[model samples]
Target: MTDQPQGAPVRLTAFVHGQVQGVGFRWWTRARALELGLRGSATNLPGGRVQVVAEGPRAACEALLALLRGPGTPGSVTLVVEQFGAARGEAGFVER
Candidate 1:
């Protein structure tokens, strides 16, 4: 459990590694982020990684992080590097 205040808005940036690109990973991430009421983007990086940024309530963002690391994602995820901070008030989740 995190020490953050319940429902406090936050930003979660996750760099997902492994077979994540060209596999509908961004679209899947966008769906999950939308479902979690987060606003950000899932973008492909140069090194075959997916960078997922989500801003929303702390708990919601954490849930999205968990989903990103879990087995139900579109492709095999070998690693997930995460960073959390204050929310930036983004509008909607997008697949970039």
Candidate 2:
């Protein structure tokens, strides 16, 4: 458990490596983020990686990160690099 207040907004930036691009991974991430009521974007980066930035309640962001690292996601994930911070007041989730 964390000491942060409940429902406090937070940002989750995750760099997912391995077979993530051209595999509907962004779409899947968008769906999951929307379902969690998060606002962010999933963008395909160079060197075969996907960058997922999500902002919302800390719990929601953590959930999204968990899903990103868990099984059943599109393509295969060999490594998940995560960073957290205060939310930036963004809206809507997009795939890029």
Which residue pairs collide, candidate 1? none
Q: Which residue pairs clash within candidate 2?
A: none
lDDT of each: 0.90, 0.91
| Tens-digit per-residue lDDT, 2-81, candidate 2 | 44566788888999999999999999999999999999999999999999999988889889999998998999999999
Q: Give per-residue CA lDDT, model 1, range 1-96, as digits (tens).
A: 445676778889999999999889999999999998899999999999999999998889889999998989988999999999877788998888
Q: How many pairs of residues collide in each model?
A: 0, 0
- The lDDT of model 1 is 0.90
**Ten residues in sequence with the least summed lDDT for candidate 1:** 1-10
